[model samples]
Target: MDLAFSPAEEAFRAEARAWLQANVPNPPLPSGDTKDGFALHLEWERQLFDARYAVVSWPEEFGGRNASLWEWLIFEEEYWLAGAPQRVTQNGIFLLAPTIFEFGTAEQQQRILAKMASGEEPWCQGWSEPNAGSDLAGISSTATRDDTNGGWRLNGQKTWTTRGAFCTHLFGLFRTDPEAERHNGMTYLLVDLRQSGITVRGVERLDGDEGFAEVFFDDAFVPDVNVLGEVNKGWGVAMATTGSERGLTLRSPGRFLATATKLIELAKSLPDTATPELKDRVTQAWIDAHAYRWQTFATVTKLVEGGHTGPESSMVKVFWSELDVRLHEIALELLGPHAELIDGEFAHWMKGYQFALSGPIYAGTNEIQRNVIAERVLGLPRK
Candidate 1:
């Protein structure tokens, strides 16, 4: 199949490129790791929102340009090519907004999507509990209906919640019907963090950044309207959310391309003592980066053609997560003695390696992705 954009797509690309060139800034290189740089990145996101460039794929009614998926890919490609800062509203716009648009009621969409798109309501995913990391079906957070009141009462804890400390809202899955099967008994709930019954405590990462948090719900009240999708059909909603997480949100080839370019630049500036292995590693990183770019092109084309991502998005997830780990590993190797350095560019690489360590863990672990490839793609027998 030819992987070329049409004339209309080319024009869209040109428009996006011009807009990015005119508005985006090339700031000082990111300091520390992901968490340390989150706030600054968020500011950059607000700037994009103000310019109407944040969510390019959503319908125009929800603050996006209603561009086709192909145009979305082209816009993202152009944005990264211009060295623009990453958007902090990514989790909100990419993951949550799409779910809301597809599965949420019209009123729900009206209440949530605009704030999310405009960066007025930052959101965090509340899927993984301490007891249920990869096995999301094991989540035991309870959301019982309060007979005396006209809402549900949430009571449980969520861990490894990214941006939990600062997020205004949380989208989570809770056990709504204890008698039903594990997956069937659940419901998706939107928790307003500003409410009285919720508590958020920071969890410092290996890199000493407090980006993730543990959130507690002590009888937190959520109106019936806050329930996402159906009350007991949250498993399907979560599955779709996971698909979006894997397909669209987490693995942006444009973001990785920008990162790969930075890695190449850093490698070039290293000492002559750089080992042959390190050089080879850098070369392989570039190749993998390019592979992911082409894969994204194919994926976006499929989306434009009204085809779902199927198991291929899982393949993309595996590719990018492993590439990310390998890239950071090579960076750490290149840093050599400075690998342990806690400041400057060396520190940034160290912090990135620490965060990259989680790639396999989040959005369903790499092991899970492999299983998906086996069972869904290869038609392997489930043991």
Candidate 2:
């Protein structure tokens, strides 16, 4: 694949860079997990929507410019370089909307994707449950079709829901047929967060924040049209989204490039304290970030040529997540004893360290990802 950007991509990059330099939050918005922060980010999303920067790869009817994949990557690079606020609508824009576009009905796409892009209705993922985390096939949540109501009655609990605290909607998986075996008899269901009989309880994590929550569905009612794909085949639909999450779509290489840039500056600040070994490690981190960037470009090239992302997504996920953990570790090492502090100048890296550590566990654990690579990518026996 050609590493150099085309003339058009270069022009797009220049446009995005200028816009971001002018529009990024001055003081920066608060964490979107908090109530006040959510409002701030919501308005910021609306601004991006108005500018058609929310999802450039989407069609104009869906509030995007119908930009090419390369343009989207260029936009991401500019976005991170500008240090813009994190996206609060990622669950909808990145994760759910892809599957929605692939499997949703015309009415569903018309109603959902536009609102999601405009931040009029933000969404959260409701995939994991008390019984199912990495092994999503073990999920016990059930969605039964209601003959009387002409819809589905959802009754189950989902845990570790990102953005659960404030999202207005959720797209999730539920067992539509208990008699069927694992990975079978499930349905992808969409439920309104404000609907009755649904309970959302936040869970505090190492970050001392309520970024994740547990959502309980006590006979929650969902309209029949809310189903994304066919009943008893939700596993396929859900995997498509999960593959996107584990691949370059969710965690763009731009983020790692930005982190690497910060690490380089930090290393310069610690010239006297930086040992030869530490310097080498920092350089390696920078290389790893570039490697991911190249890998993403290559993968996108193949995808544009009509190839699909498969178990290779797991490999990408494992590499980047572990690289994130290592990058943060190096930052802490640079900060020395001050790394433990959660306030002042050190708070930034400390917060990043906490978040990086969780990256390996979310989407799918590294252990699970490795197995997928071994069996699917390497053609090894699953047993």
Candidate 3:
């Protein structure tokens, strides 16, 4: 298979590259964690929305350019190349919205997707509990019917809610049936962050940024309509969300490839230290990233042919996450004492390492992903 873009695809690439060159912020924008930074990111999202660049692969009626998956990949490559600020609404746009698009009602689509596209309401994922991280089926968060309120009364704490503090809504799994055990009697509910009896406390990461939070729900109310799919069958429906996470929703290979390029640039700056071992590692990072990019193409092709992807997403997850950490590790090694700086051109030297280390932990830990590959993909017997 020749891995080259068609002429039309190349034309599309030109359009995307020009648009990104014209639009991406110079000196980059601030982190979305701060209030002012968030506002700017939100406006930036709106700017992309107005240009139909925010979600290019979605249907045109839902504020997209209606581009094909290949075109979407092209746009992403250009976007990352431009060093654009990360999408402020990624949790909603990537993780939650696909589930809604696949399993939600028409009314739900009209109400939610429109707002999401406009960046009027950002969303957060609420999957992990203090007790349940990788084994998401073990979450004890409860949501019982409230007849008087015509909704569910949610009560329980959800920990490690990524970007929870900046978001206006959260989508999480709640055990709707106390009697059913392990993946049974669960429901996926979308909760408004501003609701009463709910508290969100930010967790400062190793980089000293409050990017994660723990959300406490004390009889918080969510109308029945906010629940996705059948109350007790949410476990099955949630695969759509998780599948999106691992497949292509949360990231494309472009970001990793860009980082790999940055790594090479940094290595060039340290020519004295770019030994054979270091050179080999940098090349390996590039190869891994390219492998991921190709694998994504195969996955996309499978989807286009109406084929479903399953445990293999776990493989991609492990590969890319490890690749990320490895890339950052070598970057710091090249930086030497410059990596110790908390502010400067080398500021992210440490921050990137910390962030990349968390890669294996979140979005389902790499250990769990290995099990998924062994059992589901290879049909290995469980121990």
Which candidate leads the pack in TM-score? 2
lDDT of 3 by residue, 1-383 (tens): 66788999999899888988999988878777666778899999998999889988888888987787788888888888788888878888888888988889998898898689779989989999999998899999999989997999999999988778888999999999999999889998989989788999999766777888999999999998898988888898887656663333736888888889889999998999889899899999989889889888988877766777778888888988999999999998888878888788887668778888998988888999999899999999998
Give the per-residue lDDT digits (tens) of candidate 2, residues 211-301: 8899999999998989899989999988776655323255788889998999999999999768899999999999999999999888888
What ranking emerges by TM-score with the best candidate at the front?
Answer: 2, 3, 1
Put down candidate 1 lDDT per residue, 22-100, tens digits, no spaces. Answer: 8776554363225557666666667777767888777788777877767777787788878787566777787777678
Question: How many clashes show up in model 2?
Answer: 0
Collision count for each candidate, in order: 0, 0, 0
For candidate 1, the clash count comes to 0
Cα RMSD of all models vs. native, in order, equals 2.5, 1.6, 1.7
Clashing pairs in 3: none
Local error of candidate 3 at 32, Å? 2.3
Q: Any runs in candidate 1 off by more than 4 Å, and if so which?
A: 29-40, 245-247
How many clashing pairs in candidate 3?
0
All candidates in order of lDDT, best leading: 2, 3, 1
Q: Please give the range of 10 consecutive residues that has the lowest summed lDDT in model 2.
A: 241-250
Identify the superior model by lDDT, candidate 1 or candidate 2: 2
- lDDT to native, each model: 0.80, 0.88, 0.86
